[model samples]
Target: MEKEFNQFIEKITLTTKQKDEAKTKYTGVCKKVHDYYYDCNYDGSTKFLFGSYKLKTNIRPITKDQDVDVLIKLPQETFEKFNNYQSNGQSALLEEVKSILKEKYTTTDKIKSWGKVILLQFEDSTHNIELLPAFEQDDNSFKIPNTENGGSWEVFNPRAQIDAFNESNKNSDGLTRKICKMVKKWRNFTTSVSIKSCSIQDWAIDFLASNKVDQLEIEEILQKYFEFIRSKCSSDNKSYVETVLKRIEKAINYIDDGEENEASQEFRKIFGNEFPLVEDSSKTNSFDNNIFSTPRPWLEN
Candidate 1:
């Protein structure tokens, strides 16, 4: 089971080629943003990769909708200019960034302002970059635009969050990131599970921090994580949580019965095709016939 878990991790991680492509594209976009704002006190050092990409917990995209988040620190002057606006300065800031990207990606129809970030989608349908233009604060936090409501500036401290995850991951001997990636796979596989990726990572970090996880195998750790997350699930997602708990119980029963192949099939139901079945094992049950067959109400559109 440990060997199978290792294989599953390798299978779900981004390929070297995919990582290279993402770096090339995001760096190019960062360069464009930097060069355009160079005269306005924006330098090459102001841009950075954040989110799952920076944390190294990102999973291989099951769909083309996967994205890379890039933050570009705007000059203080730019912030002051926008902050002085009496109306929706957040919306204005997004539009301005969209126009700047449009200058470089003139032919791509997918470039547009999306809420707080400027989304520059590529033709390959993978690694689309979500560019965030932010103002660096004295305390190293960021003030990013939020176009929703009457428009506002939101304080973001991803660097601190990343540091915390790094500390927890090191202390756990890498179980923090492994469990995060596993949960993300579960999220991608289950259509009705709409939990945010960051929320999943936070849960893993918190769960591992409170428990003695050093002696637990990957399967045992995963079972504990599922149990821990159930309490965190809200009324909105309780049904999905119940389904996951039931399936996890079945998998554990199979493992206890010494039916490793059957256990693998049960796990596959939770984690999707990225999880490997034992050699010569029968095909697993289809998700279409399970409780996940029904789409969440909001996803119907």
Candidate 2:
């Protein structure tokens, strides 16, 4: 079980070389944006890395949805100017950013515009970058443009979210971040859990901060996670939570029966192919029966 869990972590984590390459690519993209804004006389605007990349909870995307989220912080005066010039200034700001990048990358690749962000696709890579144009408010919060719903602005503070994740991870001995990555991998591969990535991080942070569980072992942490899901599903029988609860219960049953191979397979069904497969030949009955038995903590009540 320990070996299988280790393998799962290995598969979910980005390799050192991959991280290095990603840093280089991200830096190049940021530099291009900086150059465009500089030439346009937008001196007070700055760029920030946010979302899963900044939080370090990103997993390998199963589809072509791999991307990094960046925010362009426009100064208060510039924001006011844009707003006063156009009734739908929020969307106008987005267009301004898009046009700047389009000029920079038009010869190389086409930049796709979505409702809230502009996607810059790389020709030879699966990863893309999403640039969000936002206005810096007086309180250091951000009002990002939302092109949907007839165009408007949405408030957000990525710095607060980042700080919450970092502090929670510190309290949990970095298990909060690890669990976030695991949940991302699970969500990427599972069809039942249709929750948003941001919501998933919120749920994981809440669980890590509130739950009192043994943090030394992954198995204990996973058991507590299953328990958390069970609690969330107890009130809704027809929800996706219930669907996932069934799978978690089955995995726990396999563990109780000393069927390591079956248990590993069950976990793979829940977490995806990144989970390691345990062979029948490698099964061992020498594990502490008290640690994994019937009436498991996750299965009780």
Candidate 3:
């Protein structure tokens, strides 16, 4: 079971080819943005990679909306120019950035200004990039535009968030990232669970930090995770949480009963196709009274 779970993690991770392609594409986009602002005395060196890609928690078998996030720090003069606007300065800033990108991606019709970022969607969904134009503050935090709700500038500290996650993951011996990636797989597999990716990471980090579980005990960690997150689910999503808990319980029971293949199948149902299926070595169905006898005291009624 441990070996299968480890293989599943490897399967879901982005391949070397995928990483190289994504880096090449986003780097080109970054260069274009830098060139556009270079004549204005902009240093062209403030771009940064953030989100799941930077955190090394991104998954493979990419979906259309799966994208890399890039922060491009605009010149301070540009910030002053937009800040001086009487109203909707954030919207104006977004529009300006979108127009700049449009010049380079002339044929790509999906290049548009989203709520807080300019979404540069490519024909190959795996190569899509979310470009965040930001103004550097005195304290090193970034001020990004939010065009929604009459437009406003929001302080974003991706650096701090990334650092915290790295620290937690290190302390947990990489269990934090493993659990986060697994939860993301669950989110992708089911439509009923509508939790955000960031929220999933937060939950995993919090769970691992508060509990002391053996790093090698992946199954036990997952069992505890599902039990822990049930109460954290909102009223609207409680039923979905119950569904996951039941499936995990059944899988654990199968493992306890020495039904490795059956256990793998049950886990596949939760995490989707990336989870490898175990080979059925024995067809004998031996009825045992001790099946499902293992106590799961954490499961609530």
Candidate 4:
């Protein structure tokens, strides 16, 4: 069982590395666009890479193929055309870049096909890229104002959140206490738990930055989550246990949504006969059992 868990941890960790590499590829692309935008316009500028990669490595290892995010201010837009909450200038700009690169870029023998992606090589050697354009805010962050559908690219810098995540990781000597906080942050980054494809740092940032999980709650959740992480480490069930913990997190959420029986059912799936209960348990030892084994009465009851 220990061996299996260890394998799980290793496997998940590997998945994170792969995802990180993909995001890095895109980061490279963003760097090129930022430079190209400036060189063509003869204006000085910088495009910021904002995503999981900015956080501490251990805090947000990539789990899937989520794109690396980039934010910047376009140089040519008129004041009437762009502001913090609005901008449609980028799509036209992207096409111009594509055309210019296609005409001027020289492809090497290894290159079967090439375009603007070639220019992005300036950012990183490994190439995974996604293009998002935004206007700058007074806060040194970019804003993508929302449309009626709430699908606006609108976002703010995760700098403060990243600081919080770094502090937690540093204080704990590399352990992270922002489990829920991390998940909350990632969700804002257009990631979902079912995908497990985002950098952990992104999630931690969202958690730290959003009002969803405050500091005290973050600490409290981590205290329990740590036990789960350690229990997996001790039992040698690291990966599957991690999976199970994820299930437990979801189950608790179900309970929060008024789905108590559904939550218990979810917990039972992971725990089998060792399933625990809180209805008749001692108060002093409330946090002791495996989170999955027992119905967290504070929640379930």
Candidate 5:
């Protein structure tokens, strides 16, 4: 079963075309976020970047353009001052971003402002840019309120996650980019149900939690991940994401560990054999069907 899982993981990795596509999107995300950072005065000077975008790929992976997450840092002082803050930092930064986006992306359609924090999404023109404003805590760390997984909310220690990610990356050149490709690769394979594939982190979290896989597996996966990138990705094109997916598919075929099987089954059951939040009629049973699946009047038609 472990071997099967390994095979699946290996198979799900990205391919040259997918890697190139992911890289193109990756570059766009980096540029737009960087521009937003500078535009918002959140550059190195203030409202600093403190997400996967900056760190080496393993710690903070980016799969798609939308996945290149950017969090606007609010120092302890600023975060405390905000009237109300949500665990998702970007929501907090919406309004401030609105004005800047309006000025920069003038031609963009109506950019709505609403939420625990505002959400700014710029699409229809070039690559998309989603800005999330987050407030830093007194200790320079923040946690999301509710997460399904026990570790539902991810912890960010501004300095630590970045430092830890970077320190390890030094051992591997272009580590940040490598993680991004590996993640994109893995995700592209796991959720073959449709184009709205689940993020690699989403799958990984489910797989790891359900199987009770240890950090060693994560690191082992990471090392193998490094080799995959070097062997497959190219200068003109990056097939990393697609190749990784093939590996993941291979892993999925042999994945029969009790916990993993449970998790994967649970994942398919809850996420409709794919990621949730889509309109695919065939794949819309978000709740677990086996666990007293919710009835849909529309489905009766």
Candidate 6:
């Protein structure tokens, strides 16, 4: 896998075409919001990219639900005004955002209210844009409406998260970003692992932020990531962690033996078909012809 890390990175990186499509869709989201708010006699606010896209650590999803998160910050005064007008203030605010998106994207996309965000899913595209309509607070935090729990507001600082990751990336010689992308790639392949995408990002950021990143390589950082989860995970997730950790160890051994083809195959066991396989002259005679063997335990969909 070490020999083919660059290939794996290229495979997982979003292409220019994909990025442009996402940008166009996101522009539509912003435009719809602006149009809605303009009709209401209020100025539409600025939107900030958050989550993996903001950090530039996103990998291509293996599944249909590829998510890109952005935050739309309206004025705090508007939030206060709206809250006073509704019995269920937060729910009303969230629904208002969802309603605008639903109406605007009716022909091309499907909009769903999920947690604090409105999800815009296009009919012919795998990319899912999550719009978190927020109120910009004086403290530089965002007040997001949660329709659940009786329409309460929650404060989130995505800027802080972005800053932390950027700072850590600088010190780690960019290993922090590489590790995050690699783990995301691993998670994309692990079907039975029920961890949320946000959880994965948070866990990776927190782990890498505090780690000693002096001389660690990619696989070593990955091993430590699994070990960190093994230490912190509940009994249910512990089993999955154990399985992944063993496979990682095997891949590392293959790397140590200078068997990168085998190493890539082992890494593929953990990260699925996205891990590329390259022919090696040393293994030309030892290669197996049977390609119909059962998939590795962790590689099953």
- Please identify model 2 stretches exceeding 4 Å from their true place: 39-45, 148-151, 215-217, 226-240, 282-301
Q: Which ten residues in a row have the lowest lDDT in candidate 3?
A: 283-292
Reference-based lDDT, each prediction: 0.84, 0.71, 0.83, 0.43, 0.41, 0.75
Clashes, model 3: 0
Per-residue lDDT for 1-301 in model 4, tens only? Answer: 2232223234323255656665555544455556655656423245555544444232223322433445445553522343343443333344455554444334521111122112233223332343445567678666543323423345566556656767766655443533533332323333223323233444333433433233333223533543333342333334544665577577767656755556555644543322333232333345565555765678764
The best candidate by lDDT is 1
Candidate 6, 1-301: lDDT as tens digits: 4457767877888888878877777777877786665555323347678887778777785346667788876766768876786466876777788887877677667777867888887887666788988877788888888778667778999888888778877877776677777777776677666766666667776787677755766777789888987777667677888998998888789878877777778888887788888677475644553344546788767
TM, every model: 0.87, 0.79, 0.88, 0.42, 0.38, 0.85
Give one digit per residue, the lDDT tens place, for model 1 in 136-211: 9999999999999878999999889999999999999888999999888888888778888889889988998888
User: Poorest 10 consecutive residues of model 1 by lDDT?
Assistant: 280-289
What is the alpha-carbon lDDT of model 6 when measured against the actual structure? 0.75
Report the lDDT tens digits of candidate 5 across residue range 1-301. 3343333334443445544643454344334444754545322333344444344232212222333344544444443433344354334445555676566445554455544222334453322334445555667675322222321224555577566455544543333344444454444444542222223323333333234223444334543543444433444233444444444444344343323443344323321333222233323344345456666688796
lDDT of 6 at 198: 65
lDDT by residue (1-301, candidate 2, tens digit) is: 7788778877887777766766666666666666754556434237788888788887764245667778876556666766675467667777777787776676576587778888888775555788877777778788887777667778989889998988988888878877877767776776555556787678778888788865445765765775675555334323655555577667767777878788888788778778888877443543445447646577667
**Poorest stretch of ten by lDDT in candidate 2:** 229-238
Residue runs of model 3 more than 4 Å from their true location after superposition: 39-44, 283-301
User: lDDT score, residue 80, model 3?
Assistant: 88
Candidate 5: stretches off by over 4 Å = 1-43, 56-67, 73-93, 96-100, 107-119, 124-127, 136-138, 142-158, 170-180, 189-301
The weakest ten consecutive residues by lDDT in model 6 span 36-45
Q: What ordering of candidates by TM-score runs from best to worst?
A: 3, 1, 6, 2, 4, 5
